[model samples]
Target: MKVLPSIQSPRDLRLIKKEHLPTLCEELRRTIIETASKNGGHLGSSLGAVEIITALHYVFNTPEDKIVFDTGHQAYAHKLLTGRQKAFGTIRTKNGLSGFPKRCESEYDTFGVGHASTAISAALGMAIARDQKKEKSKVIAVVGDGCLTGGMAYEALQNAGLLRSDLLVILNDNQMFISKRVGALGKALTKLLTTKYVQLAEEKATNFLKRFDELGNNAAKLAKRARSILFPGTLFEEMGFRYFGPVNGNDINEMIEVLENLKDVKGPVMLHVVTKKGKGYKPAEEKPTKFHGIGIFDVDTGDTIGKSNSVTFTQAFSDALLKLAEKDKSITAITAAMPEGTGLDAFRDKFPARYFDVGIAEEHAATFAAGLAAGGSKPVVALYSTFAQRCYDQIVHDICLQNLPVVFALDRAGLVGEDGPTHHGVFDLSFLRDIPNLILAAPADENEMQHMLKTAFDANAPFVLRYPRGAGFGVKMDDAPQNLEIGKGVWLKKGKDINILAIGNRVHPALKAAQALAEKGVDCGVANMRFARPLDTGLIDEALTLSPRLVTTEDNMLAGGFGSAVAEYLTDKQADFKLLRLGIGDEFVEHGKVSQLYDQLGMSAGQMTDHILKWKTK
Candidate 1:
């Protein structure tokens, strides 16, 4: 009889024999690995957190007692235990189970989480709410060590400490945040691991003294004090949390014991649980970063299945930056704990001294880059478009206000498939374009991407280069990157009926749409508008002169986006033309294949062609 198959809920999990819990953890790990191998979701962190999650569910009465996950990367086991086992394989797919913990998905998921460093704050709110309602349920926040690097976590910690609420915070220290952990906090956590012998001695001493009853309680207190002197959780203790453990989070028995003891602790308590990033799987253990957020892979060999041959926008950015940094010694690279994801790993390897991984602090990364630029180095802060939203104020006040020559390489600036709304980079154009002293450019292809990168560096101002996720159009690479003129666009095709103004990755699709429309005797002109901030007024004028009907397309949201910019320009000029804006609407786009999302949003070639035909007839 399979232990996992029988577990429909945490209620069922709690009924399992204590001796059989480890077997259940093994089954959970196996299930996660199998599901993730096919679905291509977060594997390493989820694998590492299996025991911790299982222990939490087994110890606590969830649905009533809340367990909030920080980023949801480690919530696969939680999901399985919370009656999502059968739907687990459908994670990260369209109309399927969400990869992250979602409140709407189940009552067990107390809070919907996608971004990091939010769980502690959310859990604190729940604890306060529970108090207000006069309920006696436990609230726990499972925050990873990587998320600790973010300033938001510290802010929550200090506030939680001040409030002195009834809260249980489990610091899941795997020494990773997507990539390898960095900074002083990581060093502090590593230092805690060195006191394993002391932890063992304290555990033994406490157990041995229990025979003396009241004296044993005092002796246990003495042991805890002695242990605390050596324990790194002194930092958390100082923050008003009753710190517990350096406990083995991988051991199901140990985790359950620790959780059982800490669950009823008064005031704010933080348990520092240490687990390996890739505990069970050999391949993930070998390369945790690679397996962190991997594609569909061969379960037998741990190799990626159906890997693309074409160069990705990330790869293109990485290659171009490498080339640029070779000649320009002043060029420095920065990432907010996303060196590998943002293609800054190559730059970090090549220029170790110049590279900086700020660790999940996007706001700091922006300001730090600004400071570097002010101090006479041309710094490029590479970040995911979604993460970049966290640093809008930093970008405006620190970089743009000062007119600092800082380049922002905003990758995955459009629909980032599978990661869904929280991860999608769709809002960059709308939010970023209005800022003064900022030049926002989006490349239509890999070739254009290189030039835009070069253009950004040469501009000597706050420049943003936004590009879509996944493989770029297999256009031939230029021999050398050239700095193209700012605020200029090129016409790909000119037609009699309507002009299609497209930007970034949508240009190729717009061209295809034009071709399809042409077959139906509906003539359409296409122009690649390179920059979003500086609207190509001349291009727009030319397009309008050719035909009154103008269709604007982008991978960004239609509201206050590229189309809005064009519309703003046209309305300001009092130009009479039929405007059909083709892009994502006011709703959040969900996780799916990029192609499927594009079709659903009416941004794909076929969909765009059909939309144009319908609008033209209208």
Candidate 2:
């Protein structure tokens, strides 16, 4: 009856009878659902992968036999079985278990992964290591169909095909990649090749051919050959991997059989397994995206608890973009595998033909947008701040160099909470602001985000509008999206005393600091400085008039950020002012609540005000 307690590692699992694995899988699914509901994690993907992970670990000798998971979101089941059951309660917490596969966490985790389409390459290296050592161990990589769209996966596949190394690639085709998969490959395979009806027909034909002894060998072989040509497996075969499946991924018995058959399979092998996301849970199965990475939901009702009263920056951009799209037919949106997470699901739905979901290929998405822009269609590619880093070269060479009008809306542009350094969006400011032909703007509020988006779209050069994660201050939106005087900073408060110029989300906190200082009989001037690239130089000259007193605040690193830009401007103008730079210092922020991180960095409203009061007194 005690299933989870018995298994310490893969070695312990091998001792168990094969028939008992179904129960173990059931327990694993229950454990995943229960833990995810409490701690909040990749629910649907992890739940869907319970049987597959269980079967793989049971069949293969892990720690000896290497297994790599692509994207790492679906590795919860793998993690749970690999002596990490105790740490399941603290998933994604500070000093707790990481959400993704981390090499430091366990010996079983052979490679660290957060980004998509990397499993094949990592597994290939492990396989190579095994071959060089003359060891008899398996190398398996479990990747989603969604990650297949990434160019890296194919690149690795091409190499694997050429090398003919013993590698097993399990394609977990759940018919969705965060949002439903886009592009012709996903459509063709799901619709025509791997359809349930088509697979059933193929199975029936194969079984029927086996009855004839004399003719069966040739006839069955011919039918099998024809099926391969007609299906998506041939595509993988052409790439140099022997292909199997369209197998039922949820069925423990079926998965065991397929994996067992492929244990001794030579060279590269791809087993395409069909699965339903959120297999056991009804609510998750119905609306998997909403529950993808949830936060403490009611398991019985399947409804998320404690809805935030505040609206996140992502929601504001989504709303603003939808309105802009309504009026301008030329405007279209694109995301690299993130539709729901980036808040572009509504836009994607409204303009199905116009919208593009270019899987986990940010580089391709950037270039594709350039091609779209060159063709005269206004393309707005909204990607996460961290993910945006992957396409920096493309932005510089393909879009900015060509002077294409492509607007990149970067979400979570600063220290994103909980997911830690890997998911943090801090580097975009340093990276994008330095680019030569690109125009980069960081918005202060919801209304400002809308206005900046319009400005970026209209700008002839490649542009980026970066905003931090979480809710805005519910600022009233009276002004519609308009073309602003480029490189402008609006003064929020007029004072003859200390000048504080802040960019993006830092502007609001600086305003609060100014108010607190005003209460303490200290007059502090405030400016909501919008553009990071073409900064308001004239305003900087005026702010320096408040002599021997000024400060620059930003939600980016103090080095090579807004503060550094301000210092550069003053130096260039030969202006004299004792300027204090306030921003994240040179250190990687840890996992915690957003507010806590701000407090730690001394960037909070109270901390800023207190510091200013002391500075004025001295």
Candidate 3:
């Protein structure tokens, strides 16, 4: 009678009574909510996907039968079912189960995924591998409708249709992705697919026709053909997948039945399952985006556990952009599936018509912004630093190459904690710096972020203004956004013995370090070097006058980051200065709080001051 005890794996799940599956779904949802509430993870998506995941594991043979989850955030339920219940307590903690699926984490996790829209390609690869090995295993890619907007998913679909391989592509339609999904294609597809009820007359006619199969074979074939044509191009079918759903994802029995039926027969079929973003959770359902990714929140109230006293760089950018958008009619904003996370929800509300959310399609969003920019409208594409990597090509070919003015407001531009290496924004400076005709600015505080936003809008070339994830240092907000000269730096502290230049979130810490050094008779000059691309040569020259020992600090990787930019500039000018470049090392940063990681990496104010003091004594 106990479903939990009998279900050790998918094999065990297959033996369970069909009616008991609903209870199993409830258990899985309960486990997810409890574990995610305590550990802090992607709660909304996992909750939404509970029944669908359970049905897949129940109906399909897994481990041998590949199941690829797009973005991997929705795999918590999958992990629990596959002997990972013991490890759920340590979710996202050091040496624990990952929040996202990792190939190394489990044999059941067929493909490692952190970013969006990769399931189709990953599952297709497994399908081809299965064919080569002469294996009869089924390959299923469960992707969110949001992920479908990504160009990579469509590319995979195009190839899948061409090859006609045996595969099952499940479209988990939650009608949301962190926030409500955007783009006309996603909405049109949902409407056409979900709203289409099987006609009553056609069903009755089919039943009647089957009675005289011997006499009506040709007529039945014609009727079936007619039905397929009349059924408004279910987007996936147009792309070659045999369309099959608009089924209720939350119905455990229905899901199991649908999945079981589709298991054996398939040459790239799509099963569209509709789900609620926060199914069964009252508060979460009411406010799906708030619960999408929480940080140790109160389960009952769904309120965030602690208050962030400092104003975040994201909030500052949002305020500045909204103010600018109010005055500038041509100004428009776009976020590729990230509105709340990027703090663009305010801007979206202020300018609904001007705002565009292109779902998770970063590549399209980048090119779309270019088109807007080319058409004499100012388009600002704001996204997370890690997600910004996905659109590098478009940024080059569409925005940078043509030298259009597209402001890229890059949030979470440094070590994003808890989410680990895949979510870290440490590599943006390295990647964006060398891109021709691109201007990159890293702001020190809230005021600087506002100023940089204004500056980015003014420059009219491809501009990237990066800021970190967490709250800023509660710096005073600018009364009105002011444009500064492009590629300039400002000195925050003046001293004679040592010169410190810090970028973005590192500036505040560097200033504190300077104050610490001042007490020890080691005078330090600090510069809030806002611009990373155009290293302020004047500031560098001036710093050299005060001290031969120049230290550049940033939250990025030490290699090819702001520090390297400074070192390269000095080398080109043939200036003599001993440099200490402090930043994240080449190795992948592990999951930890941002402050703890900074302390461990010797980037904290006290740690930096200690190092400099010890160096002086040496």
Candidate 4:
């Protein structure tokens, strides 16, 4: 009899014997590992969080008692327990189970989360709402220690302290956050675990309380005060939270006991629980970061199944930066805790002094790079396109305002598959194009990306290079990188019937569409409009001379995007060309394979050809 398939909900889980809970936890881990191995996801974090999620569901009267998860990647167990077990295999697939917690999906998920350090703030709000409504519901926030590196977590903690509401914040310290922990906060947390005296005191206190039946009821309070006397949870204590535990979060029994004891405690409480990143799976435990967010893998060997031999845009950027930095000693790199993901780990290893991992602080990374550029060092801040949204103000005020020479290398700047709307880089063109003193360029392939990187440094202003995720077109590479002429567009093929102007990753697709159209007797031309900021007016003029109809394509949003820039230019000039824009529409794109999404959006070569033919007939 399998404990997992039988257990449909937390209500069913509550009926099971306390001793049998560990068996259920094991079953949950097996299910999570098996499902994640088949359909790629946030494996290590979800695996480590199995016991914690199981304990929370078992101890709390959920559906009423709210449990908010920071960086919802760790909520796989929660989803399974909340009657989503049947559809768990379809995670991250289009129209299937979402990778993260979604409010529309289930009643058990009190808050929808994808980003980090937001749980505490969201939980505090819920707790306040419950109090005002006179509802007897407990609100708990399960936050990873990696999320603590972000300033928003501190801001929420301070606000929660001021509110003095009945809220519980469980700090899930796995000693890792995507990569190894950085900064003084991680050091402080590690120091808390190493206090020999505190460990002994905790043991003696537990033993002493267990012996006294009447005193055992006050065990949590007494232990908290006793621990406070020694090293203490001074950080949380000062923030007006009753600090409890450096509890073993991986142990199901220990977690349940601690959570049960602290359920009714008054005011704000912080329970520090330590767990391993990849608790059960051996491969993930050894290299948690690689498994943090991964693709399909072999379960037996713990190896990725379908890795491409061609270099990705991220790799191209990394290789280009490494070559550029060898001669330019003033060149430095910065990342907001995504060194490995952005391919800056090599740069970090080679130029340790020039590399800075600013943890999960995107705003800080942008401003810090601006400061570096202001002081004579040329800094390149590499970040995921979605994460870069957090530093819009910094880009505008700190870097662009001063006209500093900071290169913003934004990776995954398009329809990023599997991660869904929360991780898509589709809005970069719309948001970044309006900023003054910033040169925005998108590459058509890996070869162009290197030249754009070289161009960015030479421009000596706030420069942005946005590229899509995954492998680029395996075009022949230049022996050495060369700076491209800023705001210049190159015509790949000329046409008489219609001309297609495309930017970034969409250029090759547009060219393919043009080729297909030419076979159908429609003379179509294609041009790679490299810069989104400075529209290539000369290219547009040349296209207009060839044909009155022009089609603009991009991997960004249709509104206020590359096509919008072309439309704005044509409108200003009173041009007589009929314009058609092709890109993502005004909707959040769901998670799916990149090919499936492009085809569905009518951006694939065949689809684009069909769309253009239909429009031309119209």
Candidate 5:
């Protein structure tokens, strides 16, 4: 009765009869939905991938046979089957089962993955290693059509083809990435699947096989070869992969049979398995994009719970960008498959011609935006801070080197709760600081954000606006956007005993810390140091003249970040001031609530207050 509870590992799944797998698949899907409703994670993709994962475990000898997951969004079912069932409820929590497959987390997780388009390479590497060591275990890489669109995936494919490695690449054609699948590749898949050729071939094969006796197997092979000629995966075949069916991935038995047939079919086999994004759940099936990486929801009705009431920084950026776009006809909006996440969907709808959703290719988006800017267009590339890392080369070579006036609106620029170390945008400030002709601005609240957005747009350089995730400080917003002076810091509160210079979300907390310090008879001043790159040198000089002790805090890494910039500037100036830098530390932060992480990592107001008080007494 309890198929999931009885299962402890992949072996237990292998022990189960083929007739009982449908029930197991149902249980797995429900478990994912229920767990995600409580813990909140990548729900839709995982739900869709249940049957694939189930069949893989049933067919392959995992732990010995390596199975690599690309991006790890669809591996929740894999995690559930691979001895993580008991700890599954605590996933993406402070200290729990990881949302993505991590090698350190389990033996079944052959390679740790968070980002996309790396699975084929990793699996190929493992396959090469297996061959070198003369091992017998099979190596498989599960990649989505989304991952295939990235340049890296193709590069790996080309390399794997040359090596002619005994690797199996499963192309999970779900027809959806985080956003709807884009580009020519997705279009090709759509075209190949929807054609009458596949239907006619299947009908003819089935009827002919029915007429015959146990020669159906022979007829089935003939049908497959005929279908291959009619509706083929030519792209994969050209890449040196022996291409297989566009199989019904939802049918567990069918997948098991197909995988069984291909188990020993050597030298780079490509199996295209078509699956629904949200197969079982009705609500998720209808609105799969919204359910992709969702917050906690009521399991019964599929309504999301625990949404922040106040206006978020993303909303502020969207509103500001919308207003900016209305006046500036030259302005163009671009996102790397994250129009909804980056709050650019509204803009995309409002200005369809100007907005470009460039699929999950961040590098292309960056270079493309640069091209647009070079062509006399004001291109605004709105990407998450974490994903912005992918386009570093493009940002430097194409955008910054050319000195293009492209606005990089980096939303989720600070600690993103639950998603863990892989998703946090804390390193952007450090990485972008040294890039020449780059204007880096971090706003303190919703009001300052609007002004900063305008300021970036009005500037003639590679402007970067970094803002945190979740709700804003609910400050009074101005109707008309005002462009502020570049490379300047504004005083939030003035005092004489100590100087607290903070950026972005840390500014509000630093102000509270200053207040708390004031209660202890420690007169502390707070300044919203809006820009990270420009340093606000005059403000630092002025603050030092007022107070002997200077403290710099930011919602980023300490190494080469906002505080590091301040530290380097002060060192160069030969300023004789006791300085303290507060931010994320040397280690990768674990998953938790943002506030909890702040407290743990010593970035919270209370923590800041304590650190400052200690410094003052010393």
Candidate 6:
């Protein structure tokens, strides 16, 4: 009989003979590898985490015993086991299974997660709720060594330590998140992996538990001292958690046995398990960083099937920053544990001392960049637009309010294809625009992105340079980056009938739209409005003189964003023009191709053209 198909739920998994568990693990791995090879989801972490999820489900009554996952990078196997095996193939697709654990999707998913370092906090809350209800159900948080680097994780740890709720915080140490891990904490974790105490602890685990019962108070204190010899003991123990073994996380049988032993352990216990990312897959094992979040790949050879030579906006930003850094000694690149994702790996490689990977700490990255700026260094904090929300207060108080010369390079700024609403960069313009000293610019193409970098560097104040994901417009880059006039926009085309004011990723489409409208007897023009803040009313005023009909388009939200800024400007001047603002609406956009989303939102070249052709006569 087929092992995986035979198992329907956690209860079914528990019913399997213990000796056949390894066969089940292999089946689970094969299913994940084959499914992800076609679907192109999280590979290294999820693949490695199969045993941990399986062991948790097998040992605990899952819907009753809650398991919370951090970031959901490793939740693929969790989804598979939680009655979602039949629908697992539809992940990251239109109207399909969510990439992350969604509360609405399954009763087994105790807590839904997307962002990092939130598992411990959410699990602790669930634990407290269970205690208050007089329930004995266990609550466990599956966190990576990487999630531990984020400040919020430490804060949650501190709170959990004090609360002393019946909790299990499993630190799944694989030593990498997206890219190679960084900082003192990573070094500490790496050291802990090689220690003999962790291995010994597993060997004498049952004996040690028996000793705990027999020993007097003095002998129990000695046992605690012995545990302190291990690396993470003091760190976790000092926080009031009873720490447990560094067992093999990839070993399902070992994890199940260890978990069953610790299931009833009282008051904030932590089980430290060491697993390898891409444990069963050779290609991912060799290069786990590249396979962290991958596209579709060949299962046999472990190569990404369709590779493109096009330089993405990330690469463009990285290349421009490198060139800029070559001349300026003070230029420093910083990211929140994302060097490869933000294209800062080359910068980190070239300028080791100047680069700072703060390790999944966005708020700290912002404030740290501010500190660097204060000490006479030009710091550029490169972060995804979605993650930037975590540090809004820090940006406002530490950087913008103080008028620090820190460049905030907001990457992946609009529809980030399959990552969905949580990862989109649409809100940056609206939030950052209202900040007094901050200057926000959205580049039209790769060349303009370079200029925007130069423009941000030259400004010597709080600045934001936002750009979209995927390949740039394929325009030739300038040999020497030029600093453009701040708050000014350049006119790409001029027409007598209508003016299409566009910004960022929407510019090229707007240009195409203007041409399409012209063929359809609507004389439309396109202007690349570079700065969303200083709405280019000089160009808008010029365009208003030619045509009373104006339309504003941006990749950002329509409310309080680029389009809204344009409307606010025109309305302030009491100008008489039939304005049609085009961009993302009030609803949260779902995961799909960026093109599909753009067309759906009526921001595509054809959609923009069609909408403008039917505009009311002035």
**Cα lDDT computed for each candidate against the true fold:** 0.89, 0.84, 0.85, 0.90, 0.88, 0.85
- Candidate 5 structure lDDT: 0.88
lDDT of 6 by residue, 63-136 (tens): 88999999988998888887888888888877788888888889987777789999999999999998899999
Model 1, 204-256: lDDT tens digits are 77788987899998887676667567566778877878776676778788677
Clashes of each: 0, 0, 2, 0, 0, 0
What is the full ranking by lDDT, best candidate first?
4, 1, 5, 6, 3, 2
Residue 295 of candidate 6: its Cα lDDT?
Answer: 88
C-alpha positional error of residue 599 in candidate 4 after TM-score superposition, expressed in Å: 0.8
Candidate 3 overall Cα lDDT vs. reference? 0.85
Candidate 2 lDDT (Cα, 0 to 1): 0.84
lDDT of 4: 0.90
lDDT of 4 at 509: 93
Local accuracy of candidate 2 as per-residue lDDT tens digits, 60-173? 889888899998888888888899888888887766888888888899998888788899999998898889999999999999888999999999999999999999999998
The residue pairs found clashing in candidate 5 are none
Model 3, TM vs. native: 0.89
Positional deviation of 437 in candidate 6, in angstroms?
Answer: 0.7
Candidate 5 per-residue C-alpha lDDT over 268-353 given as tens digits, one digit per residue, 9 for 90 to 100: 98887888988899989999889999999998898999887888899989998899999999999999888999999999999999
Q: Provide TM-scores for the models.
A: 0.93, 0.88, 0.89, 0.92, 0.92, 0.92
lDDT of 2 at 386: 87
Candidate 4 per-residue C-alpha lDDT over 188-294 given as tens digits, one digit per residue, 9 for 90 to 100: 54345335555466657777777777778478557666657643377898788867667678878877867777777678989887788888999999999999998
lDDT minimum window of 10 residues, candidate 5: 176-185
Worst 10 residues of 6 by lDDT: 176-185
For this target, which candidate reaches the highest lDDT against the unseen true structure?
4
